[model samples]
Target: MKPNGWIIYNGNLPGNKFLDYAEMIQESATKQGIDMKILKNNALLSLLATDQLGIVQLDKAELPDFVVFADKDIYLARQLELLGITVFNSSKAIEISDDKIASYQYMATHNIPMPKTIVAPKIFTTGNIDHKLVEKAIEQLGLPLIIKEAFGSFGEQVYLLHSLEEIITKIDAIQGKPYLFQQFIPSSYGKDLRLQVVGNQVVAAMERVNINDFRANVTSGGAMSVYTPTKEEAALAVAATKAINADFAGVDLLIGPDDKRLVCEINSNAHIRNLLDCTGINAADYIMEHILGVLS
Candidate 1:
């Protein structure tokens, strides 16, 4: 029998784009002759009781052989794993990739080349941050730095500050949240490479450029173009993916000094629609192939 699987995405998020990602994977699975179901994160509840510790399906649905977890619902991912169902990207990997601080720290141990970063001190109360630490970060990272929140996507929570006052204001606003201050790469401003890696290889690549903004995210009005990766670029992308123990990921690379590459971020459940439109390479197909290969 062909393997059946589930692609779970966040239903509460305000867009069809989340479901769009699921449908993309579903189409790929159909082409591969596999039975794949798209599920919302809220559709199946993660049950945790003394006697029963598994999924609680309201409609009495049977669990699949594997799950394509496209959401950052780490607890549900863990619950699925505990039931012996293989979750692609895995729960731990998703957790690490979701948090910017964790992503940087995890990549650091692997000696991955990235911008200089300082983890912001965690505070319990909002707006009660230590100005001294902010001053220290400014001293170490210098002016024109990037302040990024730990739990954000689509470059929405990232800020490029040019002065100590701006940094202090941004920090004060997000004191209780997990964030980090990093040295900004001037050469990489408004330009970066998004390399989609499947398994151990880069299956597709694109360059995002936004002349109007500091962030190169397509969601932030960045334009996408087909690009070829150098051997170093491909290797760095693959290494960053492996460091997070993710099966497949979208690795963003920044241009450092002398045209060197630095890891910007890794998305475990990266959307492939833009990649397909830009490079004519459907990462969803590669993702399904990776899933089937692992299952077999």
Candidate 2:
């Protein structure tokens, strides 16, 4: 029998982007002859009872054979796993990917090539800026470094600071939030490559360039174009995905000095629309294919 599947996306998010991702996957699953459904994360309530752990939905729908988790609701994903439903990019992978610090730690453990990084100390409350620590980071990383919040997307929470005052001001504004500092790769200031990895291969790749900003995210006005990744690039992207135990992910690589490729970020539930627009390759199809292979 064909496997039953559900694409769980965030309903509370403002835009249709999340839904769009679910619909894309659903469409791909349909084409591949799999029974698929789109679900909103909030629609399923996780129940932790004395003798039973379950997911409660108002419609009383039966659980699927597997779930394509398109949201960051780790609890819900884990709840489904507890009930024996396979979750793509499992809860642990999603949790690690959702937090930049966790992701970096995993990368370091796996010896993934990345920029020099320093995890910021946890601050319990706002207005408590650790100037000495920030200075130390600057001393190690040098000026014009990058600061990234542990949890963010579309490059919105990443910052490039050129001075101590600017770093302090930015940190003060974002105190009480988990973040990290890293050496900025000036060679990749206006450009980077995004490779979508599925299973053990890179399904599609693109280069993003934003002459106007340090960040090369498409949402930050970066221009996209189809590109071919070198063998090493493809290998690195796949390795990064595996480092976090993700089934598939969008891995961004920064061009370091001497043409070295450094891992910039990994998105567990990366939006595929931009990639499709640029590469004419729908990652959803590859994802569905991978799921079917795993199920078989």
Candidate 3:
């Protein structure tokens, strides 16, 4: 009998992007002779009581052998794991990959080459932030720094500030959310590389460029072209994926001064629709192959 699996994605998000992601995975699994289920994150309610943790699924369905978590709901992912089902990208990986500060911290300790970064000091209140802190950050990173919120996607919460006033204004808007300031990579301005990694290999790669914005996210109107990563880029992406303990990831890389690749961010449950459209390669195929390979 074929092994049964579930692909869970967030249902609260609008439109078909999430579903598209699940369907792609499902199609790949189907072709590989695995039985796959597509479940929305909201469908499984985490019912917790003292000394007991379980889920209340709609229609009281039987649990699958493995779960491919395509959502950021770490609690639900953890709950599924508690039920003895394997979650690809695991709860820990998803948690770490979803936060910028945690991702950078993990990579920094692991000797991953990246732009210099400083974690923002925690601010308890919406009150005034010390100007000195910003000054110190600027002194270390210099003018035109990058401000990125710990929790955000599609480059919506990333900012490039060229002046002190811009820094203050952005900080005031950020409130107390966890964020970090990073040195701007001039060589990577409006461009970066996205490498889709499965197991120990780079499955697909693309180069994204956006002239209108500093962030090179497709949602930010960045254009993507099929790219062939260098040996170093491939190794870095694989190492970063392993560092995060993710079964699969979309590793973003930036070009450094000498044309070397620097780790930008790792997406555990990365969106594959864009990668598919750009590369004519469905990362889902490689991901399913890797998952089944490991399980076997």
Candidate 4:
């Protein structure tokens, strides 16, 4: 007996984790006596509007049984929703998780502990980057601040400024783009925990440590290690995920001074390799199970 649904992936076919997970899901479904097909977004786009609905494509004319978004492609996900397809994490969840400042506000509103931070406007039109704005944030949140580009992945455009001089230099470089000025949580020591959440449950976790650099992203030469999170840590991770309405998410937490924990960032399309390697859990399998359950 063949199953009736397909697993839609949001990335290219080869050399990408998204594709890797797609293959894993297909294999898992095969074991469960379910028929599964892996399709890319581009391929899915071509078959849209037809009865033979393609599972993978950028433009989905008809609703699929389930769709997995790789990054924060909210517009496409919403389009599929309009077609009556059940998206794993709705477009609205992705939007909130993608925006760093918005996530912080959401967490704070929910009484979740988070680092004190400020969001600078997207456009700085005064021809003068307000030093006071940064200074005030520092005054309230304290020094060793982190200035981050609002929408970046794999630690590409994050700047860690240890001194006021560095902050000025980095702010000047990013003249007119929205960014965040957040107080650095020193306890992380260039390391943080990336916890996986599914259906608002914290399923797996890993500690990413960067010994040579300040950024703890695996792509940026960080080492991953397994760490058993405390009860408080796990609770916070789950709460943060729920607050953002993320069906599947990578939640980053920084251990702050006084042995406290602060929810730093939430990633919509979290990397599966690092967490799989660290925790020895097949994240792909977990995701597929959740998707299958939803469709069933």
Per-model C-alpha lDDT, please? 0.93, 0.95, 0.93, 0.75
TM-score of each: 0.98, 0.98, 0.98, 0.85
lDDT digits (tens) for residues 1-296 of candidate 4: 33345555666445677777667667766767666566666555423575654345354444446566664557666767766777767788888887777888788899998878788766574567677776787787677788888777788878878777888888888887778888777778778888887774677888888988777889899999887888888888889888988777888888788888888888877777768777888776777677777776
Candidate 3 positional error at 77, Å: 0.5
Q: Residue 245, candidate 3: how far off, in angstroms?
A: 0.6
lDDT of 1 at 54: 84
* lDDT for predicted candidate 1 compared with the true structure: 0.93
What candidate 4 gets wrong by more than 4 Å, as runs, is 1-15, 44-63, 124-126
lDDT tens digits by residue: candidate 3, 204-265: 99999999988899999999999999998999999999988999999999988988889999
lDDT of 2 by residue, 134-242 (tens): 8899999999999999999999999999999999999888888989999999999989999999999999999999999999999999999999999999999999999
TM-score of 2: 0.98
**Candidate 2: global Cα-lDDT?**
0.95
Candidate 3 colliding pairs, count? 0
- Over 4 Å off in model 3, which ranges? none
Query: Which candidate achieves the best lDDT against the true structure?
Result: 2
What lDDT does candidate 1 reach at residue 276? 95
